[model samples]
Target: MIHTLSISELTVSRGERLLFQGLDLRIQAGEAVVLTGANGAGKTSLLRTIAGLLRPDAGEVAFHDGDGNPLDERLARGRETHFLGHQDGLKISRTAREELGFQCDWLGHVQCGMDDAVQAFGLAPLLDLEVRRLSAGQRRRLAMGRLVGSPRALWLLDEPMAPLDARWRAVFADQMRRHLDADGLILAAVHDPLPLPARTLDLGGLT
Candidate 1:
């Protein structure tokens, strides 16, 4: 399997606080890596670093194609890899349908069905409702809908199951399994057990 992401001797610091030091991690295609740690253990920070939202103080994050050669030419890190943070990123005044349309437009081509996503997320009745009026779990479901249209090979999800109910969680687990089976990679920060074949990377142990 080709390594999609590689981190070498990564070190990150916020002010005087050391987030992580001398950390090395490599994630390959078709693999799912679960990031587990207590709150404030730098799990989100690590995800941000990988997503290129924050630069590490030291070390390199390299991307490779299926041939194992470096794919350093790619500029948009979030383009080829979807990063779903804890924040819903929804426009409060916008309706659910509008938000989905905006995300689809940003993603270029739409491979997934918007109606299907709304149905899957149980947002059919809330499609015309403004996001600000939705519950916390409903907002998360809407955010997860963004992934439906993504053509990305890697997914960086922070608390993906946070607002999902039991049924939706099961559906999401199935979706994750299908993603992995299709040679996609996932690195997620999860509090509960993820029902996928995943390798746990404890951020707290990196020090």
Candidate 2:
């Protein structure tokens, strides 16, 4: 029953356009919040702000640890929150196996191994292939696999289901449910219906 994220009077602007104003939201552990909006409604911007990747023009984005106290100032945001952007962050030259190995080492945890992720994402055959050589759907699955392996408490996903097929989508949904059950929170921008229970936040209305 901890509050993972808190946003107050958040005002964000990109160039001359104001995405949203006075946006206040709180995400508690174990909750799934779905972001809904039209193409230009700033759904991705909002997610970025929460993940601490983009500072809001006005207002604050705060994070609290499992004990409900604010995290230390020196703590790295990446340790507690995982941001999965639309464009899968991958090194074109690195093979799928190498990328996962690097991430696992960087995170300093081995809860999920490369073999498990490869099987879960159906990337076994493509393990030796370079990321740039893989199809869009395959790359997305690889990105998702990386995110899932991280030990973050909160996840910010933008269009996570975009490149996934029906089978993979189901697998992702199942993984999401498991994450929620373990007291992790998720905020994803998705156009399609979610398989799990989630509260919808319409970014269009804010614009």
Candidate 3:
């Protein structure tokens, strides 16, 4: 075992359609990997599989601890990883503050405070607003805050920058940069350029 995320010969299909097959990937701490592909190219599906939301048809996905040993599944899913998907993953009735607070608390980092997370996305003003009332981009900013506030080791992000504007995109990039510098790992699916150094894994050819 190694202190890394290793995907070996992964195969995923959708209702009999083979989106991708024989896929292999490896990512380590302090590095970022970006998934690039056209629409319907299985970028989301791959991230979903890595997040444990969807089962892979074949292959193995493993996450090793800092000491390079495989962690138990329960602990791995509980506190070692974070998955931010396409959906807002927020409770509409809850205020931005409450939603983000819950996520940070779930990761056991509530004491870290959400101030930096709020400032990262400029969500300080909208903290008290209900998620339903905020604009789509605003909600996205709040969801992204969970990543910063929680400080999980491995992050699986699907189109993390989708709802952001030009200004926010830069902000998001800086956030990713900081995460990597802190020895965190990132697997992001994106069309726009990532502000930091990222090894690109384009799935366009796999389809």
All candidates: TM-score = 0.92, 0.92, 0.93
Full candidate order by lDDT, most accurate first: 3, 2, 1
lDDT by residue for model 1 over 1-207, one digit each (tens)? 234888889999777888888888888888999999888888888888888888899988888878888875244374677788989789999998899778766764455567656766677888899999999888888887767655567789999998888988998888788778888889999999799779999887443
Off by over 4 Å in 1: 1-3, 73-78, 111-113, 205-207
Per-residue CA lDDT of model 2 for 1-207, tens digit only, reads 235788889999889989999998888889999999888799999998776777799998877877878875235365666788988878999998888777755755556555566777788888899998998889999887766666667788999999889999999999899889999889999999789999998888442
Q: Model 3, poorest ten-residue lDDT window?
A: 107-116
lDDT, model 3: 0.85
RMSD of candidate 3 to the true fold? 2.0
lDDT of each: 0.81, 0.82, 0.85
Please state every model's RMSD to the true fold in angstroms: 2.3, 2.1, 2.0
Steric clash pairs (candidate 2): none
Instruction: Kindly give the stretch of ten consecutive residues in candidate 1 with the minimal lDDT sum.
Output: 71-80
Better of 2 and 3 by lDDT: 3
Top lDDT: which candidate number? 3
Residue-pair clashes per candidate:
0, 0, 0
